[model samples]
Target: MQPLPLLSGADPTRALDAIFVNAPLRDYGQRPRTNDYTLPVLGMAYIATYSQRAGFNVAVLDAEAHGLGIVETAELVNAARPRWAAMNLLAPTYEMSARIAAHLAPDIALMVGGHHAKAMPDRILADPRMANLRTLVLGEGELRVAALLEDEQRRRELPGVLWRDPLLGTRAAGIPSGKPNPQMLGPDINALPYVNRAFLPQDPYQAAPTETDRRLARNRGTDLLKNAARTGHREANIVGSRGCPYNCTFCGAAVSANPDLSIRVRSPENIIGELDQLHAEYGVTAFRFVDDLFLGAGRVIDEQMAAFTQNRIGERYVWDATGRINVLNRLSDSELDRLVQNGLREVALGIESGSDRILKAMDKRIDAEMTERVAHRLVKHGIGVKGYFILGFPGESHDDIEATVRHIRNLWALADNSPGDIRASVFEFRPYPGTPIWTTLTDAGHSPDALLAYGDVDLTSDGADETMRQRDEFNFSVDIQFGDVPLARVRSTLATLTREQHQRNQATQGAAA
Candidate 1:
């Protein structure tokens, strides 16, 4: 397969059918430093490939991957002179995306889609900053985007599309009257093409630091070496599945939040084929499955592990994926061993809170006991654990946060004695639109605009030194506190958890030395 040409420079004579843009997470000039790694914008890549297959000339501009600011990104998109400009929007990056969209040529039709847009289509459509936005794609965008690009007359009637009507103002088509219809399903996952990396940046994406990398960096006493080592490894982000069945209150991807999203998974053969292509084409030896529910319960997990083993995926390349505690705990020792043999290096768990009350509040069925049990089992099998913890909830108490701190300590202790490593990623809760918590807060008189305006959390503080500020990008917290715990207390708790994580890393580095 011939690689598609990138939309890097201006060409006055050439006109692109569509140009997909992955907006920068923030204004680059404002931040002291950016995150160490930038994830590949696979969503844009998928849409671009699907559009290209349909005979539309397509290219991708990944502003986030290239560290382009809003102005430069807009300049590049304008330079491409594409008929349609498509951008993926998220809550944290909403302003950046909107600003970039505003800068595009007025004649270029703009389409916005992503979790934020899907959750707040009306707000996005009405926002004056994005007045030129032609349409808001509500759900999975491949089919709708292709339909939008190919036909003009039928756009207003396209399912899962929200467009403005001259007379009706903002109108929704093929969606239910009040909310997203749960019965509405997106395109079949297995039918889509493997994401074409030709549309992505040629350089390998930098990945999060691994335990071995950290150990080596600490021994060498230089952060530069660690970053270089991370960049040197070719890593790719893959999504084997989409839409989570769980309705966790804080999550925007929950079934309750995205009723139109139906859970779907690509076949093992399809997944392996993509892996093979990535390895062959770009030498990507490490892969991260960014799926919300990659390792599902019962038959789903078994079939995937069996297929991976048969394909000898682990032998060729190591991988990491998100897993459910209950589902992992259900796996027998033999099954766990097979997963390790198949090259399952680490599993990311959403251990939201330690208190059972808060867990019930968040609708996380698994309790601390289940998480601990699963952690022990995985570490025993020499698989690392990355536990995600949330410090505050709407009605969370001080004791609840204490319980969470204890939970992190317990998992760290489990890994301390075992071959596997444990990492704690703590965050202060921020409510996203359309999630259960958002509804709960709104019902209790919280203004939607106020919440939306809160924007990205500023994790850095004036008192923090450079080293602490460096950790800010890894941690996220908002100024507004919706939880019962005071905002200051929440921030303090976050600092404590973060400090503990650093101390543990240092201890491990010392032990290694």
Candidate 2:
């Protein structure tokens, strides 16, 4: 049970041919702007698989996942000293990614891709503010990195080049997102092979299990957390589908220059066919689907459902996914039964806030009542529903805080170990870049990114900096309420914690030197 030895000193072998680094959260404004941090380093794991499949050496550096600060991450990266280094991004780490890329620059073939890359490839690739990057993978970086390293001719002669052009400002007219090569179409999630099942985190899901007597996936399933913990496990993530059809204003569309407008659903045949071989041949089981919305868009949920029906493995395996409360609402009794029949273990929902006001502000579209209905329904079906609630938004008044508290209480009361539901989680909100609310919150004086998300406190008026620090690790220590009381009431003393963010914002704003 000893902690994994962190190289006590710098070890050069850490970086062999490639090194994958997840950046740090310099500022922790409640929940910083780490978009896909919860997501296991799937892309890196994919590259790890590709490298292993090709017989090269690889290592994954999950700085953010491990809570390593940027300096700590850089130290680890420097120790590894891989010739080629890459980082993943969503909006929160946009600036940090740039800085990390810069820190490891001049020597490291630094690269980054994620929502930021997908949403604004050119802007990021052509970024003049941060440091210069080696080359940003245009579309799916998994195959691109593999292709680049595997074939010298193909890597050099490849169709896409998303690097910066000093003279021209940025590279252009390259391989579009739709342009696919025969070898890796839809990522032959089958042929690509699984990474060594050695590198996943140990008991990562320990925090999220439902059944009290149920065993870990291995007793019945081998999951991502376990695989990620292994020293040399090479794994890749499979996005069963892409793009979300429902219009939740806070959610962004997928990557930049992505030609596909509608979300693409891979057949259960595609997934299971490959998955069967993946598990049989490569001993792979850990998979994290990157679908903004997993199943089918609206009407075509049938196509995906049928795929599962035809290719569905009766049992003995599983995968985790995100689901629209409403999309799940569409499932009939039989379909819901099928999900339970198969291994649909966990479902994450953006029950962002209990306050109808904040939900409306985020354009969540789903009301608190709907959230409760969907949550109760999922739990009833035995699907572990992890409700994601948020605090803070521009217009949230103190009363809205009470509304959120009520929501949590309602959720808590719903969990009855004696004979009922028993699973949940909560998060506070911070505006992310490129989103509409990011600008809205900035204009409204509640932008926490300045002082909260990143580390470092401002010791100005009334200990605002300390207050911001407290907010980052802030927990609901008291009891509070909403809706008259009892029966119709929710919980106590739990505030959404967003409006206080503006307080931090104001202090930072006032203290700007």
Worst 10 contiguous positions by lDDT, candidate 2: 487-496
Residue 148 miss distance in model 2 (angstroms): 4.0
Candidate 1 clashing pairs, residues 3+ apart or interchain: none
Model 2: lDDT equals: 0.53
Per-residue CA lDDT of model 1 for 65-173, tens digit only, reads: 6667888888877766788888898877788888998888898888888989888888788887787787788778887788788875556566677776756676656
lDDT accuracy of residue 492 in candidate 2:
21
Off by over 4 Å in 2: 1-15, 26-39, 51-58, 65-72, 75-81, 94-96, 118-132, 150-161, 167-239, 253-262, 273-290, 295-315, 318-320, 417-422, 439-513
Error of 1 at 212 (Å): 4.7
Give the residue spans of candidate 1 off by over 4 A.
Answer: 1-13, 172-185, 206-209, 212-233, 456-478, 510-513
Best by lDDT: 1
Candidate with best TM-score: 1
Q: What are the root-mean-square deviations of the candidates from the true structure over C-alphas?
A: 5.1, 10.4
Candidate 2: Cα lDDT at 71: 58
Per-model TM against the reference: 0.88, 0.66
